[model samples]
Target: MTQTTLTSVQFVKSLYEAFAQGDVPTVVGAMDEDIEWYEAEGNPWHPGHAFVGSQQVVENVFARLAQEFEDFRIDCRRFLADGDTVVVEARYSATRHRATGKPLDVQAAHVWDLRNGKLVRFQQYVDTRRLADVMGVSNY
Candidate 1:
């Protein structure tokens, strides 16, 4: 009997689904323990933006979202897969804390790499200036 494994694209799709449902634990559980999660540079949320390991990722990336934004959402539009890598084209929407001015909406792309069905690395590419502006960071 041949055992079929999930493709990287499928894995990423499921992860996004979990995220959409606000299932943070499920999303974090899919990552490798030593996952390298990278957010775009110049994002003012974290001083040191690169998160290594599952704990750091959950703490710095996911937790920060919950703390800083009222409603943080990612809308995945497309996914492209090549071998062990999956590229995601998505839009981000969020309401900043303590403000009703405007919801932050922006286009973003994420490059995810998987090893043996476990997410090993992720890199984000987005308009950091726009994100910073939405976050009310001066001189962004």
Candidate 2:
């Protein structure tokens, strides 16, 4: 006989649930203390090549988002999983922008790595063009 583990789809479903509930504490708590992340110009609040450590991530990324957007919502459309790796395609839309009185709507995918039952790394991919327009960046 053989034992089967939870599918990647199931893992991501639970993860997305954590996000959709506005449960930052749960999400952050699930991350490894020394997690790494990468984001692009589309996400100016957390734009960078790569970041290390959970504290740096909390301060540089999540906190930045909280400062800029309110009533945030994250939804995952599809997911692909293999072992502990989970890749999710999601659309994020927020009713309020922290910097301006406007809405922030974005579509993106997030790749995550789960190790020892905690998310150790995450990378969000989005269109730089759309992000720029939302941020109102004057030029490249």
Candidate 3:
């Protein structure tokens, strides 16, 4: 086996793949201990929208997704990197948990900052209107 330094793009790609496969440990392991995670405000899941620390990210972000949705997936359309930051343009789709509703499909962008090969910051940009509609919120 060989070891290679993962580029910023490669790191983000690997993290998304791990997430898709429900590999929680791998996902968490990719982050710095004090990772700052942020999702757009004014969404239904605002409680879990922003947090610091990998533990907080796991509890607030991933846990909320698990509790509120099923089959949550991110389809990366593009990845662009500069220095230690990677920007992802993707589409997110998920089924509402225990509800017979149309699967939610929304466009989103993610900005990730990495240092020493571990993600230290993340901010999410999303189509709020579509996201709100899918989350069953008439207004955000």
- The models' CA-based lDDT, in order, is 0.81, 0.71, 0.81
Give the alpha carbon lDDT tens digit for every residue of 1-140 in model 3: 00037777887888888888999899888888988888877656566546889888888889878877788889999999998889999999886643546577889999998887788899998888887777777884
Residues 14-116, model 2: lDDT tens digits? 6567767777676677677877787754465555467887787878877877777777777778888877888888777778776666777778888888777
- Model 1 Cα lDDT, one tens digit per residue, 1-140: 00025667887888898888988788888888999888887777545656889999888888877777778899999999999899999999987643435568989999998886678899998888888777777755
In candidate 2 the C-alpha lDDT for residue 52 amounts to 83
Error of 3 at 14 (Å): 0.8
| Candidate 1 deviant stretches above 4 angstroms | 1-4, 46-49, 97-101
**Could you tell me how far off, in angstroms, the CA of residue 111 lies in candidate 1 after the best superposition?**
0.4
Who is ahead in TM-score, 2 or 3?
A: 3
Model 3 lDDT, residue 63, Cα: 86
TM-score of 1: 0.89
- Model 2 alpha-carbon miss at residue 97, Å: 1.8
**Top TM-score prediction, candidate number:** 1
User: Between candidates 1 and 2, which one is better according to TM-score?
Assistant: 1
Clashing pairs in 3: none
TM-score ranking from best candidate downward: 1, 3, 2
